[model samples]
Target: MTQATPQAPAFQLHDEPGHLIRRAQQIAVSKFHEVHGRHVTPIQYAILRTLYESPGVDQVTLAQLIALDTSSTADIATRLEAKGWILREVLPRRQRRLSLTPAGEAILQGMRSGIEQMYLGMMDSLDGTEQREFMRLLRKFVHLNDQQNKPVDTPTKG
Candidate 1:
């Protein structure tokens, strides 16, 4: 019989990307539910808030703004439209744009306080300096990671 190969040891705490991401998502989801109740998800609220801030934004732009794939954005938009939370309108010679309906606005208004509280709670453990540094590092990491996906020869100037 052949000898068996040795198995590799598992990664340490800092090296576990999947575990870290999952744990972070779990904590964030629980905190979000605590703030917004069980009805709304963080993603749904995020899309709604984006629409609220920039009314009539195009779906393509929205997808880019939220860092989601085109298909995922389309799915979310379709669901929100069905729920009467948003209106998707197509203008002549232009792309489809998204706008918040009155009901959507009303729901968002009700969620504003809780959302703010959720933000506060998420960072409750961090002092001002730590919060700022954490935000800075997270942004830097996302920016660099996104850069890796950029197409070569894309114009630098608008």
Candidate 2:
């Protein structure tokens, strides 16, 4: 009789950090949908929120600030423009800058309450101390790995 080959250990998907993070993102997004509906998408909200905070920024800079690819930023901007929520103006050098329309401002203002509740809902599983620690650790995790989102060409020498 031929000897059977040994099998490798089983992989654990549920205990993985990437899987957990992805699931967390899904939960947050689902909550966002439940609260905000089809009025805006998560990326659209990111674009809108960034525009609200930093008005009159060019597309490339906006993309960098939001950690999105340039094309995605442009596409989101177009979608927002289509919805009449944002206005695009060409400056002296023909550079397009984005600004939220009054309608956009109003919409963003309306979203704030739901957004707050969404945050609370997502964090409900954690106690106050755990919530604070989670926020701290999450921020640290982002801060530590933010370079992963940056251009490969931007990596500095060791």
Q: Could you say which candidate leads in TM-score?
A: 2
Query: Over all chains combined, what TM-score does candidate 1 have?
Result: 0.82
Clashing pairs in 1: none
Q: Kindly give the stretch of ten consecutive residues in candidate 1 with the minimal lDDT sum.
A: 147-156
Q: On residues 20-64, what C-alpha lDDT tens digit does candidate 1 reach at each position?
A: 768877998999998889777788888899999999999988988
Evaluated against the true structure, the overall lDDT of model 2 is 0.90
Superposed Cα RMSD, model 1: 4.4
For each candidate in turn, the TM-score is 0.82, 0.86
Most lDDT-accurate candidate: 2
lDDT of 2 by residue, 89-137 (tens): 8877767899999999989999999999999998999999999999999
Query: Weakest 10 consecutive residues, lDDT, candidate 2?
Result: 147-156
Off by over 4 Å in 1: 1-15, 92-94, 147-149, 152-158
Candidate 2: which pairs clash?
none
Error of 1 at 3 (Å): 6.4
